[model samples]
Target chain A: MNFILHISKLDKYFDNLHALNDVNFDAKDGRILGLIGQNGAGKSTTFHSILDFIKYNGEITWNGNPINEKTFDEIGYLPEERSLMEKATVQQQIVYFAKLKNRKANWTKPRIKNWMKKFDVKGDLNSKLKSLSKGNQQKIQLICTLIHEPKLIILDEPFSGLDPVNADLLKQSILEAKANGATIIFSSHNMNNVEEICDDLVMLRNGEVVLNGSVQAVRNQFGKNELYVTTPMPKEELRQLPGVETVFVRDNEKYKLKLSNPDAGVELFKLISKGEYIEEFSQQPPSLDEIFREKVGETNE
Target chain B: MVKLMNKFKAIVQETYVNQVKSKSFIILCLLPIIAIALIVIVGLISYQNAASSGNDDTNQIALIADSGIKKSIVQKDGDSIDSSIKTEQQAKHKLKNDDIYGYVKVTKNNDKYTAKYIGNESIDGGVRDDLMQNLSLHQNKLNLSNNNLTSEQIKKLSNKPSFYNYVKSRSNDNKSDDNDIKMGSLQLLIYILYFFLFFYSSITATVISKEKGSKLVEVIFSSTTATKYFIGKITGIVLMMLTQFAIYLIMLFSSYAFLSQADFAKSFIKENSNYVHQIVSNLFNINLLFIIFGLLLGIILSATAGSLVSRREDANKAGQPVFMIVIILFVLSIMFQNNSNSIIPKILSYFPLSSYFFMPIRMINNQANIYEGLISLFILIIFIIGLTYFISKVYKGLMLQNNNEGWFKNLIRGVKYR
Candidate 1:
């Protein structure tokens, strides 16, 4: 896939500590790339470098070319840190961001209206930012990030401080931005949203990318032969089945068995077939969160 | 170009709206109102106190002299004497009078005239000087009559002479106050400008530095170059200043209109006429224009400069340079008012920071010509532009520093990088 934003062998240092070490990645059009890491794992530093807020030794190319002085107007950045003046009104703040992207307020006003409506912001534009709820302010920030219709939108912790309804509204907007041919890179600690929205994932540990690939591919790569059997059998009965070393009972009658490395799921199915009716017996792979922990050796949560 | 301009406009709008939203703007707007009210209340009370105090007098003196000599010595056409022995006596008596001031006794003896002046306080040096010069003329006349000198000789001696005292400095060549009413108005000019510039520039600095110090600078920087952002900030500040000043001017004019009865206000309006002439004569008093323009240029330049070093503690430090300049410029302005044509101040006016003082002094001193004023004004304009540009260049990098160490290194780094 062609990447809208590509960072090649990026290196960043602060004093003695290497903040980002030889990081390489690509964020393509029409997709949300989830960047997951523990706190202080260079997630914010990487974003800052890409957005030209920091000086680092690397080439960050946008649309197959280096980001020189001129490319600043093309990308829109929503930093994890809040940046709006609390004294300023919502309309004023959005207009300011839009103007920075080199568009007039009049031109961006209609788009702002659409975005605020889309985000389900229920407030007056004339009200100052401090007067708005945190969730509403966050939504305003999201609208500001996307108001210019940027080609590459970087959302750092966009779902932060948002309720489910508000988060869902933001998610819809993020998806809309993606659908409009803008590439999105979403960084958040909220794994549920990450699991739902991201198709590609990059897991970082100690300022290094430990895993990167399609989400399903990464998840499918690290897992055991799994089966879910819901039957009349209890936890003790499932454990006694041939080739099953351990059985985990879930929701009373539901049973999950772990087979030996050489053993296959065929044995578990045969044991469950003896029942008059087998409720749930299926092979399943590891989830993304489980795969993340397996690959990085540290639970993200 | 379109895109860049759009971005700049948006930023300017942002700055304008944000600043207007600030509690500071409201505070700034209130300052002038409070000042004007304070001045009016204080002025009216003082005027009333002075008016009631004006009736302190106890005595008067009558000058008795022979009609022929008094007529010859004092130029009086009729009963009402524009220049007379009685006028002089009245001035002296006003000095003596618990009911009057003080009284002077004038006597004429043949060709020579003798005069006596007595007062509680010594007569003002200026008035004393006037009396001595007239007495000296009377002595010269007596000498001319005794020596039997010709009228032509007397005319040669008595003719008003040209004042030719050339001052060629060790390094240069050049030549070169008021009633209490005028003096008070002039002093008011100093305090008013001082109060307003500090109010305006410090607020601008604080507001700009605060915005940049917080997270917003990065957010704003992402969409445009620092220059455009700087322009936007400056524009917003200018708007804020103009708003405050305009309000002040309105209050000032309103007070002038209402308090037309008070001596100070009358004096202020009288000086306002002088200000008009000061402006109109600006075409001739090129020196005045240069000084005013130089000060103006310096203000705008330093305002931007103050922003360059803007950070957490920078407002305090940068404000020092700005206010220090204001204090210095104003001190020179006051000193220049007294000397008007001092050689040193004249040269100082040609400079960037000091020139603001120098130009005005030269003009008021009657030393600077229109040509010189214009030349200095032009130079001042260029210098301010160059300095502002330099500051903005430094500001672009300074805006990135979050800590003290970063601020110092980045200040230099920004300059070096540029």
Candidate 2:
């Protein structure tokens, strides 16, 4: 059905401060998109603009139609902060959120029970939300987000405050939603989780897109200038190499070196072959963390 | 359109049900019943005390008259009097000793007579009536003997009327009673409506502020438009209030009916039946429609005030000024209640918050015509609609405002920037 959501030239201003600037992104059907940035880096602002929660100078379209109220029915969103009615019962809260997504109670009630079990939540349907622990409350919130089986899901920091076990459970839930052909977009400060789950990523820095592409592609764009090696040579000798710009100990015996030239690996290989005994040497592209820092760091400079 | 409707319905249902089922709501609903029970119990205790005390005063009196009028003080049929011979001091002692219900002291000079009654405190009405009747007879006999008038002449003189009072109309007397009833009933209606308006609006404010405080509003806004969310909340809260009010009215009437079933309360109920009917009928009339619309405006204002603060704890502080404004209007309505025909009250009837109380009171007093009442109502509705529209526009922007500054500063910024 061509369920591609597109956002273009999005600009949002909060008073005199620019919150989002000329942001662009897309989420194709059955793909999970990650939005990663430091605090106040316009990640949340972009989400708000796309959901139409705030007015912005941009266009957001679903299947070539402008986003509207009907467009929201197929979208499930969990805001960055936990939004809940604390005094309400567990069943009541989930039903209310699901109903907002245009699902009937008769259809949602049983599904909620099933989701509750899948999440390993101990409380019954009638238990008040306040009675549950923080982790349990988060699980219940996750259940509310997925109970309606929305075609698109947007979760902002869905794993915050969750223990490792609960976070794993949440990751599985997101994966199941993706398996069901829903487009998923989530923002998180945890790079490992984002790298593990996201097929495409859009990184923001100071209200501008610093990087946007698939995980492998973004890493490849940074090139393979970073090299890791284990050798008998001291750290000072590695620092004195011709094309080496920076050298730091990766560990006691391993050194991570950044090269001034992308093809420095060839020169280093010749040196190792001549006399120096090398235990291990490999040329590798930068990690997502390194690329993120470089992109955001460039903007800072 | 269908999705909007569904979202609206869902919001209303959840809001209404959650609030209605809360413990605070249950307590509020039960308050009127408890109050009515308390009133009945207090009334019954007072009535019982009066009944028991009156039983001790039946057919008891001690007469200590002057010797000269002793013969003239012959007791009438069914009269019981103790004429014990004692000095004035002795009689006072006897009265304190509970030896008699009361003692009457009589002194006669030539053809003039004077009397004073002393008892434990004061004499009963029945005893007073009997004593005065006997004293009058004694005086009349003395006059008859002094003038040497025969019985026939005395009867003939009494038959000739000397003065007459006649009135062309009794409408003034009836109109005063109607005015009293209408004013009393209208005053109560306005007080209750004002209280409900304030209370329900506070509820709305609390709900809004709490949603923001918990950071749930953004997610909610993403699912529905601000207008639908605001209207749904207002509708839900108003419906809850109406349900509460209906329960209170039922409890009030049921308590009345129960109290009236007692033989003692029948007269009290009968005396107030017309006023009760007047209040009930006026409450169901067009005046009630005005009050409802006015209450809607109050809720909208509360929503505006509530949106200023980002935390629930600040809700009361944020809404305090608006709440006080409503209270001031109520006080104004009550202060000028008796002056319904005066210019002050007439002018207040056209005002916004004041009209919720003033116009209804004016209408009840027959000082405001149908046109004025309708116009007052119309103004209130328009004001509310405009405010709601304005609030809806600013609500989304305000919800996104996570300012760390004071609420007033944020409020100013929201108004200017949003």
Q: In terms of TM-score, which candidate is strongest?
A: 2
- Interface RMSD score of candidate 1: 2.7
Residue B154 accuracy (lDDT) in model 2 = 96
The digit string of per-residue lDDT tens for model 2 on B226-267 reads 778888888898888788878987898788888789866777
The residue-by-residue lDDT of candidate 2 on A3-116, one tens digit each, is 898988989898788988899999988889999999999888888887887678988888898777787888888888886797888988888888888888888888877888
lDDT for position A230 in model 2: 84
Strongest candidate by DockQ: 2
Off by over 4 Å in 2: A266-270, A273-279, B57-59, B64-96, B105-126, B142-156, B159-183, B274-284, B340-344, B404-418
Q: What is the interface RMSD of each candidate, in Å?
A: 2.7, 1.5
lDDT of 2 at A244: 92
Candidate 2: fraction of native contacts reproduced: 0.72
